[model samples]
Target: MQNEKIINYIKNWLDNYLVKTNLNGFVVGVSGGIDSAVTSTLCAMTKQKVLCVEMPIHQDISQVTRAQQHIAWLKSNYNNVSSVEVDLTPTFDAFKQGLPKTNSKREDLALGNSRARLRMTTLYYLAGLHNYLVVGTGNKVEDFGVGFYTKYGDGGVDLSPIADLMKSEVYSLAQTLNIIDVIQNAEPTDGLFGDSRSDEDQLGASYDELEWAMQYEGNPEELSSRQAEVLKIYKSLNSANQHKMKPIPICSIPSEFK
Candidate 1:
């Protein structure tokens, strides 16, 4: 789809959702990545009240800077756009200190997931206060195919405007929206871990490879070795993270019990 049409569709969807739910506005966590940048921009485009918050939890300065720049750009372009910075470093530190010790990698992974859940909690708190919906920034590959988001964390949201778009498509929309150069050029990171790990670093595959794998048919004989390797990585990730992508399982009681 054309960028303009995509923007209109998302803006209309947000408008319809607010009207349907009787919500006042949207509360989006701007993580200084293209996904968040694009999502926030779309929310701002609706001309509805958009609270674009920067929640940094011991985050890198560059990430914060990029988020601030995007917010500034939004404020300049949209009258309804407002921003606030909430540092969750102290909160995260307290939570980390309370956790039981484990292996470094395992602990780091746990802490990173906790940070996402913490941000989700923060967003819900603000959303409740303002009577706004929590807008998510997850894209198709991360949200569905690979389930890269933290369960009940970034995965917890009232609406996801760009959940249907691929990562490459998000970059395309970001370009069309004239997103800030800093954010557009910034590497995609969850900003939930120390040293600022990129999504590719964590996923073991680039977005492009993941996207290809998501669409590619599994025919080992027809694929190059490198392609097969990417597909293997994609399948492993999808299998491991399937729980996050699927709905919660519930046991159904027999009707005779009634």
Candidate 2:
């Protein structure tokens, strides 16, 4: 992809959207990942006031460091870029404590999702206070192909500048935008779990493999065992998370009843 052309297109799109909506500025949560870094950079390029928030809930120290680095980079490079660090650990802890005790993996997954929702809530709060639109950091593969994001959580946003770009495309933009080296080199993670598991660890495949599986349509029998396994995982994840990707099914009333 032509980086310059794409960048200009997105910047123009953001400008037009903000004008149409009459919003003041943009609010984005910086996660220290390539996706967030790229999104924030694009927003900053607009030369409009952009608030980059870092909401960490028992997050890994390294991840927090990377986030700070990216925030510093934004402040230094863009005059309109500002940042704030909100520690959500106490809020998360209270929510987790109120729930009934359970050792099931299902509960673990729910808690992980709750962390994302908390961050989402925080972003909206800032947006409300500042009259800005909440910008999301999900790329095409995670947002559509694997449905990797939490519904109503990380997926909750007013605008997603990189939603159409694939993971590889985001990386290309990151490099072009001169994102911080630490963030560009860091492993991709949701940073919601206590163990700090990478996205690949949770998804059972790398972004490259998952992207290929998303677009691949060939004879399964011709694939190697590992490739087939990856395909199976991809298909299962896509199926399970389809609910998050599709619109909610609304029951229509019959014409006679209406």
Candidate 3:
């Protein structure tokens, strides 16, 4: 891809969207990941008011450090960029405490998703406070290929600037944007579970394999065992998570009944 052309295009798109919506600016949740780094840089390039909020809920120290470093770099480079760190650890703890005890095996997964929802709530709160749009950091693989993000959580946003870019494309933009090495080099993780589990660990496949599967429309018989396994993983996730990829379902009432 022509990196410079894509970068300029996104910046101009953001500027025009802001004018059309008449919103003050954008508020992005920086997560010490490539997608967020590239996205925040693009927003900053627009020279618009961009608020980078870091909401950590018992997050790994490395992730938090990278997030702070990226935000610091952004401020130094762009005068329009600003940042805030909201420690949601206490809030998350209290929320869990208030909830009833559960023996379901899905409890851990549910709480992991809750962390993302809490951050989403925090981002929207900031956006509302400043009349800014909540900018999403999801990429093509996560947003469309496998639906890896949390629905109504990190998935909740006013606009997604990088959703069309693949993970590799996101990295290309990160390098051009001069994102901090620590972030660009760090393993991709959602940081929702307060642990060091990487995205690949959770997804059962690396982003490169998933990306290939997303675009693959070939004879399955020619594939190796590993490749076939990856394809199955990709297809299973794509089928199961269609709920996230599609618009919300609404039951239509019959006009005659009304």
Number of the top candidate by TM-score? 3
Which regions of candidate 2 fall more than 4 Å away from where they truly are? none
**Per-residue lDDT tens digits of candidate 1, residues 144-163?**
88999999999999989999
Off by over 4 Å in 1: none
Candidate 2 lDDT tens digits, 189-216: 9888976799999999999999889888
C-alpha RMSD of each candidate structure in angstroms: 1.2, 1.0, 0.7
- Residue-wise C-alpha lDDT for candidate 3, range 1-258, written one tens digit per residue: 899999999999999999899999999999998899999999999999999999999989999899999999999999999999999999999999999999999999999999999999999999999999999999999999999999999999988989999999999988888899999899999998989999999999999999999999999999999999999999999999999999999999999999
Looking at model 3, residue 244 earns an lDDT score of 99
Per-model TM-score, in order, reads: 0.97, 0.98, 0.99
Q: State which candidate, 1 or 2, has the greater TM-score.
A: 2
Q: Which residue pairs come into collision in candidate 3?
A: none
Rank order (by lDDT, best first): 3, 2, 1
TM-score of 3: 0.99
Q: Rank order by TM-score, top first?
A: 3, 2, 1
Clashing pairs in 2: none
lDDT against the true structure, per candidate, is 0.92, 0.92, 0.95
